[model samples]
Target: MSDEKVKIDVPEVPSVLPPAEQKKWVETYKAAFEEAQNDDPGDVVKQRQSALREANRLLRVEKITSADQAKALPKWKLVQCEEKDGVLKVVTIDGKKYSFGVGRGAKQQAPAGQGGGQNGAGQQGGGASTPPPAA
Candidate 1:
């Protein structure tokens, strides 16, 4: 129990991106901001409308062809796979809890609570015998 003060040294965290790349990115953002500020309001509105239409079109056309495609797609994590339904669902990791189905190929899978051994042996009434005597 002393009144002495201790100073702990903490190292600075290294940047994920190289300094040159970080500077380039900052400049790019700044230039984009300035350009947006100087652009005509009508032009901005038209650009936004075109972007919205393109996004809607892509969403309407998007489909998952395979499990690998679904896993490679951004912003979603596969939570469960059900072969009987020919559908697999994924939830978005970005706090949205958004779920979407991906088509699965025809494959037989064990039915729920049947033979998967998910339930304990005790619950299934499989007899558990006590060990005779310690050696």
Candidate 2:
């Protein structure tokens, strides 16, 4: 087999600003570089190394190994949770509703009719169920 290495080309990120804004960016870079050079070399190197290490640590991918750990993750406030027709309906404080199917052989309980099909905003189920107010 040939030992030639495959080359991959990466496209440059496109800038949204016009050419005039690009010139202003160069000025900003020069000012920042000058300010950085004014700092002590040893201190600057230490700070840069620390920042890079922290950034790499943060960027590293993490896996959730357990259901308990996954449940402990930060999430939106649950406004309401109820079981309806073998489906678990969860509504969050932001008015988003999610439905999860109940597993086979699991206990199925009928949800109380109170607050059924209504969101935390007191509005009926989303999408065409309620008419828009008159303009």
Candidate 3:
């Protein structure tokens, strides 16, 4: 017998959430978003947008896993976050809405060895700035 593995290719659907579930999740996100807006009531349009993105991402991962369709790269994104003027903003490919992780805590630290001495963003790992930090 040959020891060969069969490969299965699953189509990447825009959304893993079922139609009904998608609506429900969207509604939930909207509610959370409204609550945040009310609490802050400041000029944090971008931050709110980012929060919405992260929330939705988490929700999608939960839904997909529940549906037993979570593959290698569950498409989970911590949700790109940006902080400006004490307010945090988040965004994704398309205009999605979510409301979570707004002004939670300290900024995120890159997992060591991820961004070596490339892109002029400093060396990888130890967050070292290249060019030898102007001796």
TM-score of each: 0.25, 0.24, 0.30
lDDT of each: 0.35, 0.40, 0.37
Check candidate 3 and list the clashing pairs: 47-88, 47-89, 50-90, 52-98, 52-99, 113-125, 115-124, 116-124
Per-candidate total of colliding backbone pairs: 0, 0, 8
Best candidate (score: TM-score): 3
lDDT string for model 1 (1-135, tens) is 343322222122124334654455444444443344344333544434343333233222134444455457543133343322443443322221222233442331111233334331122334353443588
Ranking by TM-score: 3, 1, 2
Candidate 1, clashing residue pairs? Answer: none
Q: Rank the candidates by lDDT, best first.
A: 2, 3, 1
Q: After superposition, how far is residue 59 of candidate 1 from its true place, in Å?
A: 14
Pitting candidate 2 against candidate 3, the one with the higher TM-score is: 3
- TM-score between candidate 2 and the true structure: 0.24
Predicted candidate 2 versus true structure: per-residue lDDT over 3-56, tens digit per residue = 332221112212433455444544444444344434433354543444334323
The best candidate in terms of lDDT: 2
RMSD of each: 19.9, 19.4, 20.6
Cα error, residue 100 of model 3, in Å, equals 33
